[model samples]
Structures are given as structure tokens and as C-alpha cells.
Target chain A: QQQVKQSPQSLIVQKGGIPIINCAYENTAFDYFPWYQQFPGKGPALLIAIRPDVSEKKEGRFTISFNKSAKQFSLHIMDSQPGDSATYFCAATPAERGGADGLTFGKGTHLIIQP
Target chain B: DVKVTQSSRYLVKRTGEKVFLECVQDMDHENMFWYRQDPGLGLRLIYFSYDVKMKEKGDIPEGYSVSREKKERFSLILESASTNQTSMYLCASSRSRTGRGETQYFGPGTRLLVL
Candidate 1:
């Protein structure tokens, strides 16, 4: 089973609009959730992350809303700009397994912000 | 800032040829990972090392092997490259802290084409 699954293979949003990408995970043991943004020809960068203990976490223009019972999380970009266009990925991992050991990743969602 | 560097950005190899990909990290992270990215598969872990001289198989490690001789370096080896193995390879490293989940820093991917 794909430990994590992302929705909307591609997303298009007008500038200044809010774009949301959702992800659901199968493994209940996962305690940490992170989102990565990847541009063409570059490595994916961590955008935002949330732990199951919290319902939401926000960093700058990006926010991660997590639902523990639902086993789902989402990334929401406020006032989306063209520069925000990139492939967004959601990933999960069980805590105490040692960070960087292994992470289950979701199929990326290509987010496009229109100018 | 964490910096993970891969030796090759793009490579072309003949089928059945032995291939080696090297990765180095600037941060003194105790963990390192190698993953392959396909069009639909997103990122699939191939191998990971928790400490020097310790390696573990990931989800897709059938055709791959890994070496971790130094704390900052991890290497992925393909015994016999095949066309199906052609994909983008990524390397990542992260610090291992207690209880808290941390984000991983990634290197620019190495794209390999096996013909």
C-alpha cells in the first residue's frame, strides 16, 4: 500500500488566491508529516510540516492543517504567487525511528499559480 | 544551512553496466538516504544508512546496494543497470534528535539513463 496518497495531480490557481493540496496516509503509526516543494531541475525543499499532536501549523505563506483521527493533512498557500508554482509532495514517518532513516512519500501534486 | 551534494547530475550508461552514485553532506548528520524518482512513483527509497558502515534496504532495493564508509558520505551502487532503472536519484541527510521530528535536506538529483 502507498503509505501516503496525494490528491489533484495538478493544480491551477490565480495569483493572490489560495491553493490547497491534500494528502492522506494509511499508516497510523506515522507521527510526523512534512510537505516538500520541488522546482524543475532542482531538489525538493521542505516547505512545511506538522505533527499529529497539533491540528495546524503555519509558516509564512504556507500552512499545514493536520487531522489525526482522519489520518489526513493538507498544504495551503495563502495569496499564491507565480513563484509558488512547483511540485508539492507529502511525506510521513514514524517518530523515534531516527530521522532520515526512511520516509514514505506521496505522489507529488504539481501546483501552478497563474500570473 | 545543510548541503548535500551528489557527484553526478546527469549520467548515461549502457545496460548491464555497473554504476556508482556518490553523495556527500556538509552537515554532521548521522543518517543518509538514497531514493529513486519515477514519473508516477514520486520518490521511492532505495537505501539508507543510520551511521557509518551501517546500511539498510528500503522499499526498492532489489537492483541496488549501498555503502557508507564515512559519516558524511553515502554511495549507491547498481550491480547491472537496466532500462527500467533509468530515473532521477536523490540523496538526503538529516540530524537525529530525540523525540522531535526534523526535516531532511536533499541534494540536487542525479538523473541516469540506462540504454
Candidate 2:
């Protein structure tokens, strides 16, 4: 029930195109969802995050679209560039309900942006 | 800025050898986590510590153990390393200043190869 399922094991987008990545969670208790981007030899870093309270949150070229009832969320990268190629992971946690639980991550989606 | 540092960037050990992966955070956060990353299995939590000398096992903690001697440092240990243990390990810590699920700072990651 704590699993966060992410789709499109990989993605490829042309320059200046918008790339969308989708994720779904089963545990309703989870309210905090964060998307992380990881490079070849680095750990996953927080790119953008959103709580269930807000429908969407935007940060520069990265944005998070959330649907509380649907129990689904997605990350949209606007104006994709070749440098945007990396592995993206969606993770969720239900810490407010409980104390602090580890994040349950999905099977990451590797994204490649063509120049 | 929060800083999470790992002991090594790459490590190689024999099958029956004991291994230790050290992680330290300068942010003095209350939460510290250890995860392993595989090609398809995004990031699987191994163990986490919420306070000094307090720890909880996550989903995939069967072959791993952890120690939190100090609040800023967390260590992951493999009693008897096996070949299957080869993977990229990550260290993360989160600051509670903002609130729960605010953000997690990650280390540069350490790739371990057990042969």
C-alpha cells in the first residue's frame, strides 16, 4: 500500500519540448510527494516537492501537478534541453500521520533530452 | 545549505569481508537515511535513524545493519558481504526547520562492489 508507481521506464524528448512523468501512489496516508533528479555518479537531489493540499507547484522550469483524489502526481519539465538528461525518481512519505517513515520510491524513469 | 558526505565514492570488497559505509551530515538534522540504488529499483531504503542511537529498519534491511554513534553520523555495515550486495549506496538527511517533508539533502553516493 506504500508503493509509489512511476511510469515510462525511460523518456526521450526533443529540444524545447515538454516532458511529462507520471506517478501514482496507493497509500492515502501519504501527503508529501517529492521528485528527485540524479546524475551519473551523484545521489538523488530534491528537484521539486508538493503536498496534497496544493494542486500544483511551480519552480522555474520544473513543475509538479498533483491530484489529491486521484492519488496521482506528475512532473513536467518545460523547455527541455540536452543537459536535462538524467534519472528521475518519485518518492512519497506519510510522516505527518505517523512520526517519520522512510520514503517509498518508484522504479525510476530515465529521461533523455535531445538537442 | 545542508551537506551530507559519504566516506568513499567507490569501494571493492571480497565476498566474506566485512564492509562499512560511513555517512556524516553537517546540518545536524534529526533524520538520517541509507538507501541502495539499482537500475530498475529506484532507491530501496535499508535503514534510518531519527535520533542518536535510535534506528528503524526499512523494507530492504535484511542484509544490512546500521549504527548511529553521533547525531550527525550514520554508518551502514554488512556483516558478511556478498556478491549481490554490489550497488550504489546513498546517504540522506533532512532538516526539520521548515517542517516534515520539507526537503532531504543527499550525499554524493558511494558505489560498492562486493566480489
Candidate with best lDDT: 1
For B1-115, candidate 1 gives per-residue lDDT tens digits of: 8999999999999999999999999989988999999887789999998889999899999999999999999999999999999999999998874546778889999999999
- Residues A28-80 of candidate 2 have per-residue lDDT tens digits of 88888999999887889989988888999999999999999999999999999
The models' CA-based lDDT, in order, is: 0.91, 0.90
Model 2 CAPRI rating: medium
Best model number under DockQ: 1
Predicted model 1 interface RMSD: 1.6
Global lDDT for candidate 1?
A: 0.91
Alpha-carbon runs more than 4 Å astray in model 2: A97-99
Candidate 1 chain A lDDT trough over 10 residues, lowest sum: A94-103
* Models, CA RMSD each: 1.0, 1.7
